[model samples]
Target: MLRGSGVTTLQYTALTVLERRGGISAAQLARDSFVTPQAMADMLRALEQRELISRSPNPASRRELLVHLTEEGRRLLAEYTDAHAAIEELMLSGLSRAERAHLRSSLDGAWRALRPPR
Candidate 1:
């Protein structure tokens, strides 16, 4: 979905998840994205090295690290968001605005319903 829109899938997914979930631990991201913990850690390390994200002390858990988006990360995320929106529009070209909204809402609801309880 991302490469079709001009961004790498990993970059797009990481940015989108960070934008939506705020700062999260690498472990949490592994669970959320369905990626392995080691894979998520590797991705996070790469992102951190690129200055796109920073590993900071977690507010809720002092011993844990939280991944926060840097200014560059936000900029990339904005670009990714635009690309994603364009992809969505192209994919849903035949649907009316209301139908698209309904589909989005229903999908979100279904996902939430299937998620494991906190």
Candidate 2:
């Protein structure tokens, strides 16, 4: 990946999490991503500065802040997801659709098996 693409990975991950879950906290992100609280704080600040994330006080917990993706962030994430899918399709062009599905299932199963129990 190029220098610019490096930020895309982090941005995309954060955007996906926010989009799917609605909102999350910096501490929750630290736990989920296995990063230090400080690291998560810095990352969140960077994302907010880019206008890709919006932060607000949590309604349930005044002390905690909720992080959510801005509309611009959602658009960027959609584009990123489409580009990623296009790349995957190009890479798997040699494989049949069934083969691709099987591979995806196997990989997803392995990932789930390795995840920590809830």
Candidate 3:
């Protein structure tokens, strides 16, 4: 489903990680994305060439560079995310937006109540 958007699963994972974590080091990104350092380096080069992400030297550590997702990266991620909204709309066609929100909240609360403590 994601490849249709010109992004592979690993690339999508990298973008999603950036969206969630904001700016972070490439090594951290690789670890979070479940990729090897060498694989991450090649992926970073590809993402940079596509202008989906940018890298800057980290002031705290001259050896590591910070990675950031570009607006275009967010835009691309949104395309896939928006599809979920459409699917939800179809599945929840009988419910109003408010009802759906309430249902989601109730489900979350139930999950919290049932989950064992870490």
What is the C-alpha local distance difference test score of each model? Answer: 0.77, 0.76, 0.87
Model 2: worst 10 consecutive residues (lDDT sum): 1-10
Q: Candidates sorted by TM-score, descending order?
A: 1, 2, 3
lDDT score for residue 78 of model 3: 86
Q: Write the per-residue lDDT of candidate 1 for residues 2-54, one digit (tens) a residue.
A: 45444457755776788788678888777776678888888887887778788
| TM-scores, one per candidate | 0.80, 0.71, 0.69
**Tens-digit lDDT track for model 2 on 1-118?**
2145436565566667788875788877665555678978888888888888898999999999988889977777776676777877898999998999999899879866755677
What would the per-residue lDDT of candidate 3 be over residues 38-116, giving only the tens digit for each residue? 9999999999999999998889989878999999998998888977568667888999889999999998798567544
Model 3, total clashes: 0
- C-alpha positional error of residue 79 in candidate 1 after TM-score superposition, expressed in Å: 3.2
TM-score of 2: 0.71
Off by over 4 Å in 3: 84-118
Q: Which ranges in model 1 have alpha carbons more than 4 Å from their true place?
A: 1-7
RMSD of each: 2.8, 3.0, 5.7
Clashing pairs in 1: none
What TM-score does structure 1 among the candidates reach? 0.80
Cα lDDT over the full model 1: 0.77
